[model samples]
Every structure is written in structure tokens, then in C-alpha cells.
Target chain A: MAVKAGGFKRRSGASSDIPSSSMADIAFLLLIFFMVTTVFRREKKREIDWVSAEATRKIDEKRKNILHLWIDNVGQVWINDQAIADEDIARVVRPIYAQNREIVIAVRGDRDVPYSKINTITKQLQAAGAVRVTFATRLEQRLQRPRR
Target chain B: MPILSRKQRVSDEIPTASMADIAFLLLVFFLTTTVFNEEKGLPIVLPEEKEEQEVSAKNILFLIVQPDGSVTVRRGESEQEQIVAYRQVEGILRQELAANENLIAAIKTDPSAAYRHMINVLDEVKKAGAERISLQMVGE
Candidate 1:
């Protein structure tokens, strides 16, 4: 916040009395700004147990550009938050890819899932022409500084 | 009259000294509760479904993920297709990838194998910088 120069200017060597009384107003303004801009998001029930990948890259694609495939611990497949039969992935993915060919397929599989389930999903994605596939993993982070 | 007016002005002023405190409280709350949904992943291309190409046996690296989270590795050129233990995958793939740039790491696993096994194999392949990966269902 820009303080009013004229109000805080020193007068007759009374520099010790420089005005800081408006700091409270500035703080309140910033508080109100954040309160107005805060977004409250809902929790998704389909959060999978993600494995950590050291080679993973942070995804920068927008929400609209992603098509998600979820594989649960039981190997059940879910698309767009709805559980889908294993064979139905190709059918469901066709129209979505037909609408936008630029969309990237994000495969989120549970840590305990089977390889076949993921293979089927990627196969369906290939059939749908969604060649860009990414597996979601939590990036391994180094929390502590290494002692040299 | 002056004293009464002074008392009235003092009472009229709003005490806003706690504004910074209140703002800090909110900032702390947000800092603690904010869930950063940033996720990361190892990316791969899903090639278009087409007729299987007859790749030379020398250019393939076969990997099998067992149901019990064990991996079996084999060189594509071997006639007998000997399966090695899962733990040695990284070293074998690393040496193979270094030797052949066009080597395809083909992963086939039983349906009963857990997903974790597949990811582990894929991770090692990625670390080895294998140029291509083929994922297919293994028939019983």
C-alpha cells in the first residue's frame, strides 16, 4: 500500500512522530481482498493412493485439456467420475476425443491396481486417438537438507 | 464545552489496531488449509492402434510383471526367452538402452498382478531412458 507522503512528512524536526496509524487500514484492505477472492473447493471421493515417481514432471495442462481415467485398488475403471465396465472404455472415450483431439489422457491408477487394467485403458486411449498419455504420481520431495 | 467535545471525538473513533492481527489470522488459516492439487507424472505416448509391426527380435526388450510383484526380464534376441529375476531389471535395461537406441521395452503382465508392480517396472524403464514401451495384456 502506498502511504500518503504528505501525511507522514516530517515537520519542524518532529520526524520521530512519523505517521504509521494507517497501517491498520492497509492490513484490513489486504484481508478483505483475500476474503473476497478465496475459493472453496470440494473434496473428491476418488482420491487414489499415488506412487511417488522421481522422473515425473509437473502437469501444466488445463482442466479442460485433460481426460481422466481412474483405476481403483480393485482394478475398477472410472471415467469422468463414473465407474465404467472394462470393455466400455473405448466407447466412452471415442466421443470425448472426437470433440477435442488436443486433450491429454491422464491415467490415475491405485497403487495396488493390476497391470491389465492400466493396459486396457491405454489401449482404449490409443484407439480413441488420444496418444498423449500421462500417469499421475506424487513427486518424491526432499524435505530435509542433505548433510554434506 | 471543549472537554465534552474532546471526549465525544475520542469515543467516535473506531479502534482498528487489531486489523493486522485479524489479517494474519486469516493468512495463517489459508496457509495451513490450502491443498495444492499439483500432481506430477511420467509421460508416455500411446501410439495409434494399428497392425502389429514385425519388429526385429534384437530391437525388443521383454519384461513380465508377476502377480506377486516380481519382475522377469528377457532379451528380445534370445531364442529361448529366458526369464530373469525382477530386481535386475534396471541394470539390464540400462545396459540394453545404452547399446540400442531403438530398443522397445515391451511389458506384458498377468491380470492378477497388482498395479504397483507395473508402475515399478515402468519406473525402472523410464529411469533407463528406454525409447519405446509396449503395454499389452498377457493371455492365460
Candidate 2:
């Protein structure tokens, strides 16, 4: 019986440690899954000169709640990658406001654009019943502030 | 010769003990380095359409921006206008706001004025911590 017990000890030589061979495969699978599921934003970047401000703040609203309205230096307005006429702004934005009541219009106007163009856009936004607005600007450092 | 034959019989599997550590290191590096492009701006709420409220003229502070980028400050119910550089607007508005808590900063920009000129004045007014702000266009 003692000889059989000694022989059984040889049969019980299975590894007590957890197998690590598949760990790399699991991590690689997660990495590939994240890479596949990630959606990249592909908005075309407009090259308008950004206005800088000392009072610039980060808009804390969610990405979905904010809408980008770009006004180029020539006073041309662009929304959602489409060039929109000044007269048609309210019409275009009304439906979007209807779809999402919490939509905040982010006016990314060029610094050289006339104030009248911005005024007109604000009026159109008011007509569309979307009141919350943000003027997107770069943060200006106080050291480089131009003295009048 | 027997040892050389035994060496040839060894297992041919590649070792992967540290693969998880290497992958996790890469993941941590990417996670720390990835920067999201966040939205930034000066936030303001516009009044609803046709929702004009009658504010007393004494409670209004006019900041008239010209096409030349100069600012003309005018108090409500006063004919006197003070022309100052855009940089001094914050100091002027801060003093006025201290005396009158219900003061409204009415920024009237010329139609032909560059947008930055208006924004400069607006930034100063906002810096002064004015709660009631009205944006208007000249000759509108």
C-alpha cells in the first residue's frame, strides 16, 4: 500500500500555478476590440483665425449638446460641414433645436468677420428658440496682452 | 552525441510569460498620453424671441464699439459719453457695477466693426462679472 501511495504522488505532479499562456491573447483581443469599436470624429477643420480672450472658459456641456457654427473671415457661415446662407440659418437650426432642446450653439467666428454677421447669426438663433450660446475662443495669456 | 540529440528534442514553444505585462504597459502609456479635444468658450444665454423686458434707462451701461476699435462708454439716463481704450473697460465697468447691482451692460457694436473689437470689449465686461449683458448692433 505504501508503494502504491508513492506511485500516486508521481501522478499528482500537475502544476499548481495558474496558466499564463492565454493572458497575452486575452489582452490583445481587448486591444483590438477597442481599436475596432472606437469611432473617430472626422469633421473637416476650418482654417479661420480664432479669436483669443482673457475670459475664455471651458464649456462643460456634453459634446452632443453643443453645436459648432463656424463663421469664416468673409462672413460665410458653416454648420455641420455645410455652407449655410445667412437667411437660412433659422430654418436649418429650428429642426435641430426641436430634436434636442438642450442644444447650445457654439459660435466659432473669425476675428476679422464683421460684427453685423455675428449679430445676424444671433438673431437667427433667437428665432430658432435656441438661447444658450458660447463664443468659442482661444485662451489669451495676460503676459502677451497688447497694451492700448 | 547523445546530449546534442537531446537538445534537438526540446520543446519549440515561444515563452509568453511577460506578454501581459508588456501589453498592459502599452495600454497604460496610451491611456495616459491620449488627450481629448475639449470645447472651450465664453458661455452666454440669449433671451428668447420676442421676450424683451423693459429695463429702466438708469440701469443700463452702454459700451458703444466703433469701426475704429474704440469704445464709447455711456451711462443710462446720461447724455455724457466717455471715450476710452478697450483695455480700460473692465475698470470702468467694475466701478459702475459696484454702485448699481442691477446695471445692464449693453454692448452696441458698429456693423462694420471687426468682430475682435467687440469681443475685446465683451471680454472686459465679462471679466467685471456683470450678470446682465445685452449684445446689440448699431443702426439695427
For every candidate, how close is chain A to the native chain A in TM-score? 0.67, 0.76
TM-score of candidate 2's A chain against the true A chain: 0.76
**What is the docking quality class of candidate 2?**
medium
- Index of the highest-DockQ prediction: 1
Please provide, for model 2 over A17-127, each residue's C-alpha lDDT reduced to its tens digit, 9 standing for 90 to 100: 888888888887777765665545656779999998889999998788889999998889999999999999999999999999999999999999999899999999999
lDDT, model 2: 0.90
What TM-score do all the candidates reach, one by one? 0.76, 0.82
Whole-model lDDT per candidate: 0.76, 0.90
Model 2: how far residue B40 lies from native, Å: 1.1
**Candidate 2, residues B1-140: lDDT per residue as tens digits?**
36555545677777678889887776666556555777888899999999989899999999999999999999989999999999999999999999999999999999999999999998999899999999999997
lDDT of 1: 0.76
To one decimal, what is the Cα RMSD in angstroms of model 2 from the true structure? 6.0
After superposing candidate 1 on the true structure, give the runs of residues whose Cα lies further than 4 Å from its correct spot: A1-43, A98-101, A139-148, B1-10, B51-54
Best by lDDT: 2
